[model samples]
Target chain A: MSVVLSIQGLTKAYKPGVPVLKGIDLDFDERGLTAIIGSSGTGKSTLVRIINRLVDPGDGTIVFKGEDLSRIHGRQLRELRRRIGMVFQEYNLVERLSVMENLLCGRLGYLSPLKAWLRRFPQEDIEHAYQLLDVIGLSNFANQRADSLSGGQRQRVGIARALMQRPELLLADEPTSSLDPKTSVEIMELLKSQGEDNKIPVLVNMHDVELAKRFADRIVGMTGGRVVFDGLPSRLTDDHLKLIYGGEGWLQ
Target chain B: MSSASIPAARPFESSLGAKLLALFILAYACYALGQLDFSWPRFVKGIDNGARFLDRMFPPSFKNWDQLLTGFIESMQIAVLATFFGVLISLPIAILGARNLMPSWATWPARLIVTLCRAFNPVIVAIIFIKAVGFGALAGVLALVMGSIGFVGKLFMEAIEEISMKQIEAIRATGAPFASVVAFGVLPQVMGRLVGFCTYQLDANLRNSTMVGIVGAGGIGGTLFAAFQRFEYDFVLAILITIIAVVLLGELLANYVKRIFNGES
Candidate 1:
């Protein structure tokens, strides 16, 4: 498959001399899930955040379809951001807004500010939001306030909101961390299926190792802000786990 | 259990410093009372004068009904108009001052404007406006608008600052422009609080408008001032009672507005 994204020598440190993702090189081309698993504070979130431009990379070059994502500003950055959809750990739905309105937020980039302010979203977007609502199994909840939803329901809506962008690439930052096990699996399934169906690469940073192995087509294991393992789930040995996470007293 | 392992049985203690501070406050209060013209005889004479004044004000005569009616209507108009204009102006300033959404360059100026508006009392603001715009209802409206912006703008900025950044990020990631991000993400979170601010400004404006008239800016205070100056104590009492009634009515109306905007059927 042709490369959709390529990251070269990505290095970042919140404080200088203590790098988070140090000289990391990765590429995404295939249309499926690639899970990046690491213990907390390994800069998995920071890696994805820089890709979304939510966090600026200290030193690196991110090329998405031959465009340097790290250097673009203002209008160019917004145009680039449209092709990349991100889902947060907290679901991030506008709490006081209606479910339908929250979903329409996916199209906020497409509509003018005046149109959004007036809530005059185009007809196709409204229909698409309704369809996405059904896909996420919240058909009757379009009018319900987002705050009334459970954690799982909100995450489901969050996934749908991301999908509404029709993004070329989807980045999820520990999407299932706040969810129960069942909900986590369900969310993973939704992300995987949507990734395949839309033919968009899904890059996820997760804390749960087994969950990543089960759902990911390819797994990248990281430790201390560096990638330690990159291969299939079968190749992810206990030795590799120990190397990635360091010291396995809890593994017993 | 060992001493370190076992938690303390008593988790609370009143410090000696606190007790000392309380005693100092009490002593200062006693000293201040002694320094004032607060003798028992002075208090008794004051009470006697108040009773005599109340007796004269018993039959509150609305002898000049037309003049009273005009002043009352003018005050109501001033209050309503000021509230409308003030809330509209404050809305943008509030967004500007929110640290989360805006940078320091924008927030500092907006904050300074809000502070300037709030620094002066409404009567002081009214006198300033009277000097600028000439003695009329226009001065009252301008003064109250400044007061409303100062009071409501700070609260609005605080509400905006408290909103979830995740909400803004989600919309922004969708490729939405800055305006759309604010419209969909920022405004929804703050709309309820904004409605509350508007209603409060209205309530405050209603009271301030009448007072502004005393400074020759406009309203019922002019009539009240004239009555007091003419030794028409009964008419002054009538005006005072009418003011209290209107303020109470305004409170009820404000509550109703708040409820309607809160989306309670």
Candidate 2:
């Protein structure tokens, strides 16, 4: 019901004169799935990354949990990050580590470096990891190396690893882009259900318009870094799609 | 028409300068050989002496078994100790040297230290350390530690450089501390490769330990050198056999270490 993450006039430009995110403004609620849908090079991924501060915004105010994330640095920034979780397009699980170990890595911010290095995780954290693995349907594969899993299974581990943080907010950058259609739907469903179950906002950047419509409670469409559409999925019409993607031939 | 059929060809002949350079190198090699008096007679005489020496090396005698045993054990100790400390020290130094991980200023100092350590051959390093530490396993250990930093440190830095930056970015996004970032992101990607480097360095240190002793650094090689000076060829043969056996045993142990760390293995 309340704003969990508030972004106001967020801007990013890799080159001084060439701005990638011209000026963006959006607010994320504390529950349900919010899909960021846009065509390629529209700065959807950039917007998500800026939210997590993986890519620094040129100028913006990102106020999350009453703290301005853009202004924070050092230990304060790291502490802020512990409350937020992020997933990647490529899954990005440490390939050499076991699923159990990779899941525990979500708690890396909470553990001492010496303890993490020694794999001396707290019993509660280990129990929570196992519970998360079970939730993600990867209980039997906990001891298996991440690289040994299939695309969908690896993404499951990726999700479980993020959930291990017990984060207040979740950001997934194209979580199902590499998967097959059936697997993509399954991953989307998992993400949607988990977001609802945890009562946390999950902001996902996706190119699959149909998949986004199917799962998103609210759809935010962008073009050239500006919000073009912000409403329920049912309200996203052909006119909105034309504006979000540009040109009518692709839709046909 | 296919793209392959396009004619963009040229003559594949060497330029005049290249031909003359080749000719000059051949001439210089011939002149150098001539100055060195590398004739068939000299080669034949050398072969005859080699044959006589080979004849003397046969039928190895373990006349002083107790002394040989003590020397062999010391060689093993020197190898194990040097390898353990060398790999231990190289881990953090290698991380600091990685160009991708650290700034150029930091990498330069780390790289320079590794280069200087590797610049001297272990035998030369052993000679210097023997002078400093007064002739024992301590000198042998120090020399091999330099060797380990030279080899494992550089190799470990290379391994760190080759890792996927995308993985690191994902971890950093979590807002993990610097140390946590290394433990979760950097170490996982490089751990298997680091294990491989350490075991190979250990095997190399095992072989070099024998040679360091010849500089009076306390190992089986010192005993073998003394036997050669005294014309105790049979005792020397015994020491050589012991060295070969030790090197092979170290190789097997290194393989086991690799297996334990390699996920698939």
Best candidate according to TM-score: 2
TM-score, candidate 1, first chain: 0.98
In candidate 2, stretches whose alpha carbon ends up further than 4 angstroms from where it belongs are: B1-12, B34-48, B255-265
**DockQ (Cα-based) for each candidate:** 0.69, 0.63
Q: Write the per-residue lDDT of candidate 1 for residues A131-200, one digit (tens) a residue.
A: 8998999999999999999999999999999888889999999999999999999999999999998999
Cα distance off (Å), candidate 2, residue A94: 1.4
What TM-score, to 2 decimals, does candidate 1 have?
0.91
TM-score of chain A of each: 0.98, 0.98
Q: How far is A89's C-alpha from truth in model 1 (Å)?
A: 0.9
For candidate 1, the per-residue lDDT at B260 reads 91
Off by over 4 Å in 1: B1-52, B259-265
lDDT for residue B201 in candidate 2, whole number 0-100: 85
What TM-score does chain B alone reach in each candidate, compared with the true chain B? 0.86, 0.88
lDDT for each residue of candidate 2 in A142-250, tens digit (9 for 90 to 100): 8998889999999998888889899899999999999999999999988989998998999999999999999999999999878999999999999999999998898
